[model samples]
Target: MSRVAIIGGGVIGGGWAARFLLNGWDVAVFDPAPDAARKIASVLDNASRSLPGIYDRALPAKGKLTFHDTIAAAVEGADWVQESVSERLDLKHAVYAEIVPALREGGFIASSTSGFKAVDLGAKGASVVVVHPFNPVYLLPLVELSGPADLRLRAEPVVRALGMYPLQMEVEIDAFIANRFQEAVWREALWMVRDGIATTGQIDAAIHMGFGLRWAQMGLFETYRIAGGEAGMASYLEQFGPSLSWPWSRLTDVPDLDDALVATIAAQSDKQAAGRSVPELERLRDDNLVAILRGLRQQGSGAGEVILAHEATLPEGGEIDGLPVTASRCVPVTWTDYNGHMNEAAYLELGSWATDGLMRIVGAGPDYIAAGKSFFTVDSRIRYLDEVQCGERLSVTTQVIAAEGKKMRLFHRIMTGDGLVATIETLLLHTDLTTRRSCPPEPEVAAALTRLARAHDGRIAEGCGGAVGERP
Candidate 1:
């Protein structure tokens, strides 16, 4: 198994440990802090509950996590070392000094520094790349990588394997890319607070309730492109470019974070928290992010594409109780409802995908559909058996009831660790996409389906042949 050593055990460090461990990398950590293990454990628990739901496929089994007393003990056989110590040049250098010699052959180190130049970091001549991740590292995919070209090249694929996107910085700069923009926004937000222009809650509302939502999906330029109307980005710039030079006063000035300002900000932030602990807030943030990402997944846009792309790489197909396992996935936040369970419509969506899965199993996959033939659902009956909650993994196993000529029937069992949760019985007709009429499938596909039907003959599916509420 691949191994990673984590230095420090603060928020960022703990997040890194959780990221690596969930991706199935054995993690060794060294931190003298007494609560380090507890902190990492808490992060791991939060991560475990949320991260997998963002994907339609299962992540690999979690890895072993061990804490060590000395840095060397953790670093000795590691394939990669992630340093997330406090943002002190001397402290970082000291950690690097101990890490370099202890690294196994071909091992490298990545610093989770929010902002620090590569030259300054490698001044002591130990090669390290800046791989900065946003908070709640397990979910956010962006990681800014800066260092020598060779070092970055080596790190990029590893990050991608963990389902993260690596942003390569060819030119090293202060604070890297994301934080620079953030610093500008923060400076402006602070000025607004100092000038009493807006309170913390109002500023937050401005973000999540407006531009922040826009930014989350289309981002600045693309969203502006819409504002450009019939024209594109060029028209957008022409219209708004001149306004940027206006006296957007106080940007050049710094806010005085004195006692009053700090107290004002602190009190407002407390109100914003509204009695939810930091961990509770993190859970809320994670749920909203999952919903947004899954929304994007439907359009194959933004971070959803990353997840979709990664899911394509996940292995599929298995059997359960003599039936073919057709669909397996974590219930996304979008799939839940006010009832605190999977929505009724969401269950139909699950059954639809399971039908698709069964198609692939019987020689009717993407290529077959692309060749102008596919199954069209004609009827479906679903019996809801139990509750399915957000983040719960659900698997659908299909038992073919009939497969003759242009008609096929399927009974799907939806299961969780708690046992069978739902059952769907569906009927489908093979169709000619061009003719838009019922038709025979390809010879091979027909034969395969027939064989499957024969194999499943004489088996009893409890809810098979039942209309809704018949209780068959």
Candidate 2:
């Protein structure tokens, strides 16, 4: 879709805008709050690093964002409207009323309300879908989808197009999917504090030290299935089922919000989270999640696998300019090492830089590089055809040897002078940024490659001799 309108430009709305814009969908933001622009800009900055880190490839061009003074103007010609207003029912009703008058009949509306059921909002519009996403929306894949089944069916592909998973809730329920899970854990933790059986630190330690790690890759049921050992989930469930009658859990009981209990929990939580500001904690979380998910992606498992598949559908290098160089970097001073020559890795780095420059030429640039879609080196055959002392000027040239769907054969030559060919030849594959797996370039990108391939057709890469196929 060409344009998406986001209402209530708070954190969730801003995040939604980032995801869509990164995927090449133009966005318009509508919020009466004067600070909406600043909030969205911050969201985009965070996403620039976080989103790109997950994928080995580059994303599509970020779409143009417009700030509309009125809701009507924002909704006009919008293919989708994402609402992220306050959680109160009255506020949502008012926002919905304001939104509906401006929205076209077929335009899709997704509410970012955590607890509100889609049915409540659907009465106002036939095409409304409740799409509640977790915090750090660009990185997190889970999005709860509930509403008219038909509306959800229509909305799922759009959600997928933005590199997110649309989880369908079988029935409309308050708190939807994740919040219900959160409430259950919250209740148990509160009761532990009321009884003085477990400190907040103890509870947090228990989770982060154990289940949290498992949960990152496998959900509760899958984890239990493994714990079942030889028999599987059924055998484990049958063995554990008999213990259900025991008073093992006080999960249903309510804890009074007493001052002493609150203080104890709060103090313990503060101690457990000591020495880290919210932003620092967020960075730590992002780092850990990226590392873990990236590992899983390499293994072709868990959420990493799902994200990998989502990225596969993204365009490799479209008609705009060039293939995005996801691995581009300037030569680092440290890369010179002890020798006067650039380190071997640094040669690879320069080659990557040249490839990126070529990508910009084909059309993909910073904006397209943000969406988790781009190209990756499958194999490289570099020949140190010539080596000169460090501190000399250097550059690289890239040519498309062959382009067929997701696989493109690239030949790169690094040179110290315009006439000399220093190093060359890299075979590449179009990859989904999320999955880090090979995928065919999108049709538009492929078409552009056909032209690029022809332009670079009959030429052989300058240096393709010495032990050429080694990875840097």
Candidate 3:
């Protein structure tokens, strides 16, 4: 039920809006430009399609979004006010001054300014906090928090709630941490282009095809730590320390971005785009990010850990068509095949989780497994009824079939808004984990499964008992 007021509607502002709105914050946006609404809508469209794919559970229900003509109307009763206007000091100061009088008593202003220090930004004595986020705010989890210690403390929970990392800055400096590194690399890249040493495409490939992958998981210093062999970090410093004195990078030099260089860069960038619109390019980037993030999520590393933590806080399960919902989530890009629809293997994975869900309902969850009693799936059959695309929200409902002494049967329907996409019929046997052999379940779990079986007895399942290629 929390509300956020967004001032500005450029790329960064829209991205902030999308992140907060999708995370279930009521958003009020104030942007003077006439096309701001359309721009924000496009960002939201991309965000809604990709952000939730990073998590196992669904994000919170989307909250209300309202556009206002003035900042006062937007900031009234707001829990957090975000200022993402142009980088001009005068403009930001004006926005902050207007925001303070109307901001709720407990609310604070968050500036998306990348380089401004809090001391300068808070000249008006407003409760301003620097919460600069990266491009595509909904997908990138890093947000630099700098300002009043109390205000920064207040912002951490809110940032975590949106599945973002709040990397606190004990000392505020220009451009913060991540962006400073980015600026250094950018300077080097620019120098390379100016020197005619590399084209935009080649430089991009060098990063994406090489160290970028390393950076995604281990980051810079850790990657070098591995490079140090068995000697570790101190050895790394010894090996690379001398190179710092060498003139290897032009980080300190400025490249003349004259018309010729600008033209060359623009032309190369257009070729790289290959006729894709901005939105199209954005979708491609988001898909790649989702695929990479999900892989890292499996390892629980870096930003993937942020996603796992937030997903744990999310509420799970509900009923659909009077059946207990087992697994519900948006299809991630990783689940799709070359044919561009969900692969057959994903259907099996869904069924497996649904089986886990049913076991949990029958008092045989992770704790039961830890206690040495659990269910092991011996066989399963899936009948895919329709195509499922990436980003589609799927709800799986499980229907208990039979719960005899040592065996349990479940039927799962994987559905989208259009209708059922697949049906899974799986059979499991109760097993003692310690012995790794089949066994009868505890009395309570057995009785619970029996109750579910009796409740679903009257329901017809056409796809059950089917062999390969069998049709109902």
Candidate 4:
């Protein structure tokens, strides 16, 4: 197994640890802070509950996590060393000086520095690449990679394996790409607050309620391209390029970091946040991200597309009792209803996923669908036995009850840790895409289904063929 050494246990460092550890990479963390272990553990708790909620399939089992007192102990035998110490050049340099000697031979080193350029980081006489990751690193897939082309290329697979996107920079620049754009907005916000033009809450609303949604999917240029209407980007530039010379933006000046200004900003931020604690705020943020990403996943656009691609590469579920464990996932916050349990629609969705899994077992998957042949549910009856709340783990065990020429029936038990939560019985018909009508399955699919049906014929569970009120 690959090993990653984390040189700090602050927020970013803890997030890095969680990302690597959750992805089944053994992690060694070295931080001098007395509460470092507790801090990292807290981050792990949030990550464990949040990261896996984004995917339909289960993540790899967590790897071993060890905390060490010294950097040398942490870096020894590590495959990758990530330094996330304080951003101060002196502190980073000191950490690097200690880390270089302990780094395993040929192992790569990365610095989670947001401001410093790669050249500045290399001044300490070590080859450390700038791999700046966003906050809540376990969830956000984008990581800015700035370094030599060779090192960046070599590191691409490792980053991708962690379920992250590596955006390599052609030239090493301070603050990198995303942060440069962010800094401009941040500076402007500060100026607005200082000048009493807008409160923190209002500024936040301006973004979250408007362009933020557009930016989440199409990004700036593409979003504007759409705004161009029929004429395209040239029209957009022609219409709006003159605004660049306007004195509308205050990015040219930096807000004074004085006590009064700081206190004002702090008070405004407190008012904006109301009574929610940091953890509460974090959970809220994560939930919103999850909902947004899932919506994107459905459309297969932007970051959602990234998630879909990564999910496709993940290992399929293991089998259970000669049949596949079709569905296994945690109920995300969005799946809950006003009744405080898994919603009715979600139950049907899970059943559909189980049916899709069975189809895959019979060689009728994406390729089959692409070839204009698939299954369409003709009827379904769901029996909800127990309530499941958000964040609860759930699995579905499927049984093939019948499989004939063009028709098949399936039964699925939705299970929680304690016992069964619900059951779904569904009837499906093999379909022809062009005609939109029932059709016989392809030879290979029919044979596979026949084998499964034959094996499961006598092994039907007690609830098989039962209506809502009728139990055998």
TM-score of each: 0.94, 0.72, 0.96, 0.95
Candidate 2 shows a clash count of 22
lDDT of 3: 0.91
For model 4, how does the per-residue alpha-carbon lDDT over 1-472 read when each residue is reduced to its tens digit? 9999999999999999999998899999999999999999999988887777778876777899999989999999999998999989988888888888987777657989999987888896888788899999988989999988888887888888888889989998899999999999999999999999999999999999999989999889999998888999999999999999999998999999799889989999999889999999998898899889888878988888878877877776676666678888878777888897889999999899888988887899999999999999999988888899887778888888999989999989888879988889899999999999999999999999998888888885766677677754
* Model 3 bad stretches (over 4 Å): 466-472
- Candidate 4 residue 254 Cα shift, in angstroms, is 0.9
Instruction: List candidate 2 segments past 4 Å from native.
Output: 124-127, 317-472
Q: What is candidate 3's TM-score against the reference?
A: 0.96
Candidate 1 regions with alpha-carbon error over 4 angstroms: 466-472
Per-residue lDDT of model 2, residues 21-79, tens digit only: 87788999989898889989978866665665565445666789899998889888898
For candidate 1, the TM-score is 0.94
Q: Kindly list the per-residue Cα lDDT of model 3 for residues 390-436, writing each as its tens digit.
A: 88889899999999989999999999989999999988899998999
Instruction: By lDDT, rank the candidates, best first.
Output: 3, 1, 4, 2
Q: Once model 1 is optimally superposed onto the true structure by TM-score, how far is the C-alpha of residue 260 displaced, in angstroms? A: 0.4
Each candidate: what lDDT?
Answer: 0.89, 0.74, 0.91, 0.88
Q: Which residue pairs collide, candidate 3?
A: none
Candidate number of the best TM-score: 3
Q: Output the TM-score of candidate 4.
A: 0.95
- Better structure of 1 and 2 per TM-score: 1
lDDT by residue for model 1 over 13-118, one digit each (tens)? 8988988888899999999999999999998988887788888777777899999999999998888889999999999999999999898876667999988887
lDDT score for candidate 2 against the true structure: 0.74
Pairs in clash, predicted candidate 4:
none
Cα RMSD for candidates in order: 2.0, 10.0, 1.6, 1.8
